[model samples]
Target chain A: MSEFLIASLAICGTFAIYHIALWVHRTWNHSLTAPVLVATTLVIVVLITFRIPYETYMVGGKWINELLGPAVVALAYPLYRYKDTLKKVAAPIVAGTLLGGIIGISTGLLLAQWAGFEATIVYSLTPKSVTTPVAMAVTESIGGVMPLAAIFVMIAGIGGVLMHHYVFRLFQVDHYLGRGVGMGSASHAIGTATSMEVNQLEGAVSTISMVMSALVVSIIAPSLVQLMM
Target chain B: MEKVGKMIMHIGLLYIIFQFGNWIQRTLHLFIPGSVIGMIVLFLLLSTKLVRVSWIEEGANYIVANLAFFFIPVTVGIIEYYDLFLGKGSLLILIVLVSTMLVMGGSGFFSQWLMRRKEWKHE
Candidate 1:
């Protein structure tokens, strides 16, 4: 197939899969239908079945990826809108994310190592709490594989999205800020999306937590890894 | 045409903020990413009444709503590392699942505790 045709197929296919996933999520309120997971799986299946290279798929996907920066920047709106709530809970939010980042990285590193995984995989696992972009950078700087970091980040995200509600309920954590910070600190964008589904204030708080966790993890991860070694 | 123009203007403003963030990073040698810096800048702009929410609200909401689409490519890039994951994928998944749960639990409980403490102090 031609590049034009492939690009069209890639874009159209992703759109279709994401819509279906969104429908499923809305209908059943299941986090398992996260659009990113479903769309990624469908896109990969299509690429493999057709023998299209990943690079080729990205020809169309890159357009969507470019928007990620803006989308992240756009988080400021909700953050701004919810600034009063943020101010009220600022102390706990900061403390929660800071400690959460440390706990997440340390626990992931220890487990990966205890499992006897390679150093590279262990390093990749270190930044699993943050979003992909920051996780990838941390992985590379810490001498891990970047792509593996993305995978770990996704796994962490999906895991958080799928389980956070239950985890919060289990602990009787009904506070919006607590729930938001918990999900965002551990799961990043996916968790933020899940929190958004619950409430707007929760979503905004999650965005703040996600950004703060990214900064904290990136700064502390390298030194923590050195200390562990 | 007008909507397109507005969207462009919104994104352009974001780009300008991003540039300011980049400059700050370069000047101070901060480890923070430009987009994050831009987010903070925009937040301050909104807080101080320098920028109205309506100016970028539509574009921002539209972009944030469809944010998942933007990550599909990066997630699919995981195929490039299939071998690394293939052998230990289960273990990695287990670690991710367990640690994520622990992190969520820890954060939730910690924050809840702090909130309760504040409430008690007030009482």
Candidate 2:
């Protein structure tokens, strides 16, 4: 097979699968139907059943990943838009994110360690709360496997989205502010989307918390990994 | 037509910043990723009025809004680790879920407590 032809086919195939996943998410409105989860599964199934090489798929897939860099830079726009809110309630958001991030990282590291996973897996769990690009990057810097980091991030996102309401109710977190910060700091982009689905103020706060938490994790994960080792 | 052109042009600007961030990281040997450094640079630019939000707003929004689409290719890479996770997958899932529950509960209660305390002081 010609490389160029395979690349085009993979790109088109990815878009088709993603759009179908988006439609299913639109109709189902469930965490399980999230576009990322659905589309990734579809693509994986197609590849495995066909016995296609991952290198072949990545010929075109790398093009999409290239956008991730500029996309990360683009995150600054949302952070900029919410400067006022950041200023007004910066104390609570920062403190809450710090507290939860510490607890989350400690729990993840300790649990993964106790489970008898290797050093790499435990290190990968360190930055699992951040968005994918950042989490994967942090994982690499800390000498962990990127795929495992991505999987851990997926679990954090989908699980948080699914379990947030019950957790919030149990914790008696009635206000949108608290809920938003919790979701964004703990689960990153997916949790922000969940907050958006419920309320605008919640979404905005979630957005800020997501960025703030990413910043916090990026600064700390490497040393934390070093300490663990 | 012009609006779309402007958006694409803004993306070009951001791409330049991303490369610049890569250069900075290589020179400084920083642990943070180039993309994140670029994010911080872009944030500082907007806040300091060195770069106007209008220049990047539409392009950035379009990209971030479709963030889930970008995850497709990378997530598919998980196929590479099939055997590595076969038996241990469920255990990893349990660890992540429990950690997430702890984070949500801890963060939610902490923020609400602080918020209530601030409100009480105001009253």
Candidate 3:
């Protein structure tokens, strides 16, 4: 088959699979069946079984991936929707996210170094707390493996979303401010989505926290790596 | 026709801002990502009332709603490292998972404490 045909197939096939996965998520309504998790796994399984290479899949996949940047830019909209609360309660939000972003980076850096992974892997782990698109760009700027950074962000986001309830309960995080910052800083987009599902205030605040974490990490991750290295 | 036009205009404007951000980052040799800068620029525009929410709300909502879908193409590359991951991947995953929990607890506790402190002050 021609590359164009193959690429078109890959693109169309992905959209179909992702929609089906989204259906499964709606039906099951569980974190384990989350759309990103299920769709990614399903696609990987199909590719491995079909003997299609990752590069070929990406011929068209890159077009979809390129939208990630604009999607990130779109985050500003939701954040802006909560501008009043942001101005009214900016102190806790900023403080909480600053601590979370720095602490998350520090602990991940130390853990990765202690694990004795390569330097590239360590760098990738530095920006893993932010959303994938922002994390990917930060990974490149900091001389890390970009893909690995994305994987780390996904893992952190999913894991944080899954564990957030227990974490909040145990920490006595009864307020929306606490819940929002926690999920947003640690989990990024996925966690923010989950928070939004549960509470509108939490969701709105999570959006701010997520954006702030991205901005904070992009600025400090490189320096933190340098200091620790 | 108007809705379609507004949607197209929204995307085009966003892309231009994103590119403009990239240009600034490139010329000034800044480390921050252009997309992030664009996001801030948009937020500032909205806050300043230079851009109305009605104008760009739809496209922004669609993109943010399905943010995960956009990254699947690149993230699927994790499969290529199947061998390496299969070897000791579980351990790496565990470390990140645990740290994620720690982050949640730490941030939640800190923010909650601050909020409570503020409440106490008011009382």
TM-score of each: 0.88, 0.83, 0.84
Error of 1 at A224 (Å): 2.7
Q: Looking at model 1, what is the TM-score of chain A?
A: 0.88
Which candidate wins on lDDT?
1
Tell me how far the alpha carbon of residue A128 in candidate 1 is from the true structure, in angstroms, after superposition.
1.6
Better of 1 and 3 by DockQ: 1
lDDT per residue as tens, model 2, A1-229: 8988988999899989988988998999875676777888899999989999999999999988887788767767767787786677878888888888787778888899999988888888888888887888888887889978988887788678778868888899888879988999888877876665565567667777787788788887666666665
Docking class of 3: medium
lDDT of 1 at A10: 77
C-alpha lDDT score of every prediction, in listed order: 0.82, 0.81, 0.81
DockQ of each: 0.63, 0.60, 0.58
Candidate 1 per-residue lDDT over residues A108-222, each given as its tens digit: 8899999998999899889999987789889999999987788888888877877876888887888887898898999998787667656668888888889989989999999
**For model 3, how does the per-residue alpha-carbon lDDT over A169-228 read when each residue is reduced to its tens digit?**
887888888999998999987777666655556777887888889889888888988899
Candidate closer to the true structure by DockQ (higher is better), 1 or 2 = 1
Q: Rank candidates by lDDT, best first.
A: 1, 2, 3
Local error of candidate 2 at A31, Å?
A: 2.9
Q: Write the per-residue lDDT of candidate 2 for residues B22-95, one digit (tens) a residue.
A: 88899998755687689889989998999998889889877776666766776687677666556887788889
Q: List iRMS for all predictions.
A: 2.0, 2.7, 2.6
